[model samples]
Target: MPGLLYLFTLCNLVIGTGAFVLGGVLAPMASALGVSVAAAGQAMTAYALSTAVLAPLVLVLTGRWPRARVLVVSMAVFALGNLICAMADSLPVLLAGRVLMGVGAVFTAVAAGIAVALVEPQRRGRALSLVFIGISMSYVIGLPLGAWLGFRHGWHVPVAVVAGTAALTCGALAMALPRTISAPGASFQGLGDLLRRAEVLWTLSLTLLYFVAIFCVFAYIGPVLQALLPMSTERMSVTLMLFGLSGVVGTVVGGWANDRFGPRRTLTVQLAVLAAMMLLVPLTRGNHALIVLVFVVWGIAGFGMMSPQQSRLAALAPAQAPILLSLNTSMLYIGTALGAAIGGPAALTVGFDRLAWVGVPFALAGWLTLRLGVTKGASWRPA
Candidate 1:
């Protein structure tokens, strides 16, 4: 079980790192491929869009397959996508590679969540959190490593590394995970019925809004740090590490809170904290010490939202756990794309200092949505 969890997490780390490390390499990629930074940005957007569109579809189509087989296949596809990315020299080919990668990532994410849930009902929160740690580690280690590699060896090196990681993850999953099928009646109609529930809609809405708010500020974090701190490359890397470390801590805290307090209340508190931290970000510019403090708080508040939100979604849609979780993941990537699209223009017009201010209302909106759902008799019990 531990081995399965580690492999699953590693899959997430590679996919996430591969998808996001492009942000750091945008200038170099644009120069090499003879495209504008805007075009390279669009390629990233394409990746998210592909993930969002494919996640539910893949989950529904593969609903009957042995979970372990599904996971192995997904990782294999992910490896191939990265291989494509590593070899591609043209803009169109790169975009194609990203699309393939996104599809593989979407499937792996959904399948992993379902596999974790199957491990132990009581330990669901911990299991899911452990898988998501891959994502947090990607933020903490993979992205920084990718950036460093991109700076030293060019953009292709990181993509190649991600491909290698994906291959290793595939092997691990094949060897470790047991073959398991979904319970009877876990079909597409079950997923449709879950989607029709108001509580499920509310939970997903909260997921979407929270991600929008967090990613809005996060999408421009590098640029914001550059503009505000004006740090040497070494110091900037250190700052990134600090932010990632904080995320790991936050994930553990959120998992603990979810298990102790239940998902709804924990998520509500985390979202509120996130809103408060966003509001504080504008005040911390140019003060390196204060900036680090704010980032740690932001990491705690932002990454903290994930476990509770996911646990809530799974509990709410018990009959269609895999599909619902897959949809939630899709919403998350969509939220990332939306936030990036909105924030880029906002940053261009209002500057990075004001980006946090722009995200505050979105966080407040998420809190309100979750709060309203709770008031309307959405039970906290696991589905």
Candidate 2:
């Protein structure tokens, strides 16, 4: 179980790395593929939309398989997707690879479900916290390193690294994870029953809205920064690393808060702070120090919500935990696609100067959703 935990974390790290790799390599990928930067950005949208659309299909198909076997196959596919990405010579081929990677992302929820299954109920939050640190570390180490490599070598080098890493983690998971079948009655069909609950739907809606707000601003952060100040790729990488480092702290604290207090209160605070950060971004335009400071707070408040949200969904529907979690991931990427889609056009129209203005409403709406719909005046213990 411990081995599965570690190996799954590594796989998630690879997923996290792949998620943002294209953002960093946008210019180079665009140049190489003979497409515009906007076209390259579409690869991100393709990856996200594909994940959103394919989640149910993948879950339904793998419903009866041993989770370990499912994980192994998924990781192999993920590696193959990255390999295709590394070797692609045309825009269409690259987008296809992105779609393949999105399909393989089903394993992320599977891994989270497996981790939760292995731990006691009371410890699930802590266990998930440990697992999610891989995501934060990807921001801190994986993203910057990929960007640095992309800047020096080629865009393909970073993706090739992801392929190699995924392959290694696939081997580790195949050996480490037990070849045990899922508990009886844990079927994908149960997802429909769970979603019928108001609380469940509201929780998922909050997840979607939160990411939409976040990615709206996040998708164009590079352009926003470049517009505000002349910065090198190395400088941008380092700045983003600091933001990621803050996220690591936030993830740990958010998990502890969820288990120690409760997800409702924790998430309320996180989302409120996130909304404030979004509002403040427009004011910090010219001052690099202020912008960086806002980003640091944004990192904490933004990424912090994830662990609590996951814990909340699990608590709300433990019977449907796996499917619900998978659905939550689907919602997450759906929001990502929505954000990029909206953000790109809004940025183009209103300019990057006012991008965060559009994001603020979504953040506040997320907080309101939790407060009014999910929590309903519930009290939680303080840490």
Candidate 3:
């Protein structure tokens, strides 16, 4: 079980790293391939879209398979996808690789979450957060490492590293994870039935809106920092590291808060903090130190929303744990895609300094949806 946890974490690390590393390499990749930066950036959108479209469908289709076999196969697919990415010289091939990786990423997350729940229901919140720490670590360490490699050697180096990691994770899972079948009666119909509930719809809506706000600001963060602060590139990297570190702390804190105070209160407080921070971001211009401080706050508030929101979704349809969790993952990626799509155009129109303002309404909307869910008694209380 410990080995399985480590394998799951490693798989998530590779997937999360691969998913966002392209952002740092977009300009170089575009120039090397003789394409616009916008075209290169589409690789991220493609990956997110594929994840959103495939997560629930794939999980439902393969829900009855042995857990260890499913995990190994998923990691293998991810390894192949990263290998393809490392070898690709054209934008289309790159996008194809990203799409393949997206499917594997979603599958890994769904299977891992189900596994965690099965391991211990009482500790599900902490278990899920531990699995998600891979994502937080990617931002904290993986992206910076990828950026350094891409800048010094070439964009392909980082992709090769991710591919290697994926292969290693596959081997670890195959050797360590226990073979287990799905719970009796767990099927696509269970997922379909869960989705019919109003509470489930509300939870998903909140998930979508919160991600839209978080990703919109995050997607354009580079330009926003450049425009607002007079920091050197190295300084900007350090600031991003601070944000990532704070995000790791925030995820842990959110999980603790969820277990202690319940998901409703934790989510509400986090959303409110996020909205306030976004609104104050523009005011932090002209002071690099202040910008860093604001980023720490933003990271704490923004990332703190993730665990509680996911926990809320899990509680929404407890019977269809795998499918509900998978759909929540899909909503997150869809929100990310939507945020980037809308934020890019908004930045072009209003400038990056105002991008923070653009996220305010979405954050408010997320808060409102969450409040509605709470009012409707969708929140779970431990007895």
lDDT per residue for candidate 3 within 278-354, as digits (tens), equals 98888988988888888788888777776776677666666666666777788888998888777777877777787
CA lDDT of each prediction against the hidden true structure: 0.76, 0.80, 0.75
lDDT of 2 by residue, 88-130 (tens): 9998899899899888888888877876777777777777877
Collision count for each candidate, in order: 0, 0, 0
Can you tell me which runs of candidate 2 are displaced by over 4 Å?
A: 1-3, 181-186, 375-383
| Winning model by lDDT | 2
Provide the RMSD of all predictions against the true structure, rounded to 1 decimal. Answer: 2.4, 2.5, 2.4
Instruction: Kindly report which residue pairs in candidate 3 clash with one another.
Output: none
Lowest-scoring 10 consecutive residues by lDDT in candidate 1?
A: 179-188
Instruction: Point out where model 3 deviates above 4 Å.
Output: 1-3, 181-186, 230-233, 377-383
Q: Assess every candidate by TM-score.
A: 0.92, 0.93, 0.92
What is candidate 2's CA lDDT for residue 347?
82
Q: Relative to the unseen true structure, what is the Cα RMSD of model 1? A: 2.4
lDDT of 1 at 9: 74
